[model samples]
Target: MWFKHLIFYRFTQPFTLTADELEEKLTAKCFKPCGSQDISTYGWVPPLGRHGDMLTHSAGDFIIITARKEEKILPASVIRDALDEKIETIEQEQNRKVASKEKKLLKDDILMTLLPRAFTRHQTISAYIDRQEGWLIVDASSHNKAEELTSCLRDSIGSLPVINPPVKNAPSHFMTQWLSPKAVLPVPFALGDECELREPGDEGGQIKASKQELTAEEITGHLDAGKQVSKLALSWDDALTFVLGDDLVIRKLKFTEVIQDQLDAINAETAAEQFDADFSVMTLTLRKLLTDLINALGGEIDEASRGEYIEKKILEVSKKQQTAEETAQETA
Candidate 1:
């Protein structure tokens, strides 16, 4: 119902599916509980809380989707204890020290047996499709996790015209300019009292200064002395506050007290109505702040070479998957 983080992607081409159409497509891969012997499962869930079977949640042109991934949480220590005890018992009975390969096989057997009875943990990530704006906003802090959502989506709908959206201005330069401001500050944005600065390179020189006014001499001195802003905290038009990273990941999100107070006034007679209202308000706030942020950063980049970049990123991810598979095969 409430989203805390975002990883955004732009639709490089037109996306013309309606909510009903989307639901029909996604229903093919709707969430299923993990089997007794299964390690993990990922699929779509109803974004409209406990009431609906449909996966897509719509607020005007925004079509929201939630992904639930459940995985068994078998601890390594538990397995280790069981394995050590078994090894000791075998040694006392009829065995010498177990070979390393034999020990590994025994551990694997134990894990497979324990998995059926192991406790499971589930996490749901909410995402919204801004069809009108040609962007998909996923509630994820990691690029890999966000891309997992994208992969699930592509599997569901057959195709998606998405790529990691690029901002025209480099984040470091943009933040430095905003902090010192030789020119006027970007409209609809204000600096907050938290920042992390780093000297650029592999040497790993950095400073984290927070709760002090960013404009003050103490803070400005770091910038003047030879540090570039790697991550800076910002307040967005009193609706949301977050730390913006140089890679454009938004973290540490807290809705401003002002927006919450306004939201509190919109009481609904029914639970469903309340749920709808909450999502609508949240989605609108994100849309406004992100749209403005994108605009201020010279809007989304539309270069001829962007297609090549997207293909390269996809290839990198593909290579990672291939490498992982090869490693697993070798290990096997």
Candidate 2:
């Protein structure tokens, strides 16, 4: 499936597991329907759903996986009304106010009572592992949801040595540079009519513009007043369009007509075949887009340097912990 957003992580160490090995590990956590009284469940699922039975779908060098989550839908208002009624009844009958701790226990009991009857909602997030690129790209709009899939994968595979890959330049800084008075964006990158600018400081003001020329006097005026671009929409080679954030998260990703034309050319006969074609073409296009985008943003931090940086940070933390322990001992 085409991902509408991307939150990618880079593997610190080499990803050596083959598709079959991964499928075996994932099978241990295959998705199952939530049980009565269960609030939520998370597990692996087939990438192609009913069209394909395999837990992992391999396209070229990339392997695709899906995580399914199911949660009961218990409204806060309903719970509040129920709790109020019960609390009022207990207080009236016992002639005393319910304590905070007692109220918490009552709420827990109420949840258990209502969970089995509550309607359920389901969502699935898909991700692809690029072994050669050492990237785990998730189709999630938020970092929290993306981490849910990675957390499940870590539990399945024992460990996942992945990090939010670092880049040489800050995304916001570089993006702001591109829109500066004398700057020019890299080849094939053209500005779209949307951006968010924020002033510098904790309490700084922010503004958003949509469907307006980014080079307009009003926008550059914000930059002149010491504001930075936090989010900017841009297109790549007429193939893909997306909004890049200061945090390097890609949002509102759209594969353009160029990509669609390629898919249309495939014209696969079966549903499974179409799905396969879409995944293959989309992944390939995305790979190219990532490559160019990274270069334009001054490239990714190489693995060796990233490893060294991580080691230094870990050592610093360890020293701080040791110092804290010594202080505690002295105080004791």
Candidate 3:
């Protein structure tokens, strides 16, 4: 509600006024603008006027005197004087309306409905029901008058009630948990060991072996045999550095190397199945490699020292890979 009423003004031409001159003008009664101070300080019905501008009041006060760059210069004082006179005329009309017997209430007019009542020569106060809060909102140009009126209204109502400031907006209640920032957990993916293999010869002669496990030496042999790498495994420390950083990293190591190495080993194995069996088996092996890698990287991360390390390492490796890829592409 406050944001809606917040006003900002940008002058077409910058104003030139000395600090002393500005202060002097602000102090003058004739230069004072309605609602120049706190708008809500008065009451629900704050005095209305332009938020910020060079203007005049009928008392002949120059509201704002600042330099203008225009060739045909307009004195702010002169414009203010004219506007002030016009405002006086308008005030007279408003007074007449207030006095008119035929005037209709601009707001709720139910008999005995709480409405502003003159508290003193300079002050008027009122109370309104705040249905949302089940309370009453008081308004008055003078805080003293508002307080007095609040007491009188309560007495008239014959019930003990909470007195509150004017309600410009609805009551708000926030759930504490809702206001808390959410922690986004990293997405989970199955590790190489978890990947299931199709039966041997499922893809004709494309694959041969369908085993789920492969030793480190066997993995290296596959790489030597020129098979495409699909998965790889690493020690816990290596996995931690790859996924969570040496300081903060969190991505699992690629299983491509492991798969490739395994393929080579399978080729070298004397028990290697038929060409079709070999291809089929390698495909399943690749899947297992990926599953294992994921599992290794997904281990619980040390939140303190290890957190920052992992983050830094992950970033470094990612940057290096990206750079290498770019270089290769450029060469091509």
Candidate 4:
């Protein structure tokens, strides 16, 4: 999987360098000769640091070097002596290049800290460091001890600043794809386990029915009453009743169409009223009504004319209800 990775770092003081300039400086300073071998022959692995600043490296088994902006350079001799005393299989050339790269990398990339984790599992770490702009990116696959790794690196480097990469908000089980077949298999069930089982026609048994055999009549009662149905003017009571009943789905569709029509009518009226009166309020009302209609239909209404009509209808209904309540209170 391709991950969106970032490097983070902090500086004691601010320093400035363009991207190209920083890159060039790091390449020059970090790449050094090993004995008589040409520096070019040695591998000059580019430094990876957080926020692209703070070059870092495993100086030896016991030491880590973290260099930042304006920090004094640790002498090559000091590094050589430390490695010879502590680290085994010391390659003079490789050690020099590694140390040089650690310092130079810190000055190239700069960024802020976002996430930090204890290094407890990795044996080798990928270090990213940029100091000029202030960033450090570190990925150590070798160090598995988080506290030991972090503490060791911090202690040896004189602590200019250290940062960890951001914790990704990735889905759990993201590595499911990488799991081995054996690891992914389900556990075997033993015989005579207490799992639920049933015979045909057993008491409290699971019920099964075919969709083709299940008719609407079986679910809902027959509506054979010879009652006449008539189309009625739109009202809040009727609308609410439809919404809270089985007719809600069909009613919603019809209501949305009706609201659209109303919006069109309002727009036409507003255009005509532009010469006679202020239709601003009416326009606003219509817009609100259209919005409600769209909401009722679980859709979006973006047209201004439609929104105005919807708003007007909603306000009119609200005012009517308020007036009715006031009259009832007066009578009481």
- Which number leads on TM-score? 2
Q: lDDT by residue for model 2 over 1-332, one digit each (tens)?
A: 89999998877788999999999999999998889979899999899989989999988889999999999999999999999999999999999999988998899899899998999999999999988888889999898899789889989999987867578788989889888767889998999889999998889999999999898889999999999999999999998889999988999999888988898889799988998899999888888878888899998777578778667645764696699789999754
Q: Write the per-residue lDDT of candidate 4 for residues 31-86, one digit (tens) a residue.
A: 23332211112212333333223332321111112222111223456555544443
Least accurate 10 contiguous residues by lDDT in model 1? 176-185
**Candidate 4, run of 10 with poorest lDDT:** 110-119
In angstroms, give how far residue 267 of model 4 lies from its true place. 48
| TM-score for each predicted model, relative to the true structure | 0.90, 0.91, 0.15, 0.18
* Model 1 agreement with the true structure over 182-214: per-residue lDDT tens digits: 546588788888899898787968989889788
Report lDDT per candidate: 0.84, 0.89, 0.30, 0.29
Q: What's the number of clashes in each of the models? A: 0, 0, 56, 76
What C-alpha lDDT does candidate 2 achieve relative to the native structure? 0.89
Cα lDDT tens digits for candidate 3, 155-266 = 4334333422122221111111111134122233221321111222335222122233432334334433433222221233111212211111122433345444545665
Q: Compared to the true structure, candidate 2 yields what TM-score?
A: 0.91
What TM-score quantifies how close candidate 3 is to the native fold? Answer: 0.15
Give RMSD to native, each candidate: 2.4, 4.9, 34.9, 30.6
Model 1 RMSD in angstroms: 2.4
* Poorly placed runs, candidate 4 (over 4 Å): 1-15, 30-43, 46-135, 142-332
Against the true structure, candidate 3 has what lDDT? 0.30
Evaluated at residue 328, the lDDT of candidate 2 is 93
lDDT for 45 (candidate 4): 32
Candidate 1 lDDT score relative to the true structure: 0.84
- Identify the leading candidate in terms of lDDT: 2
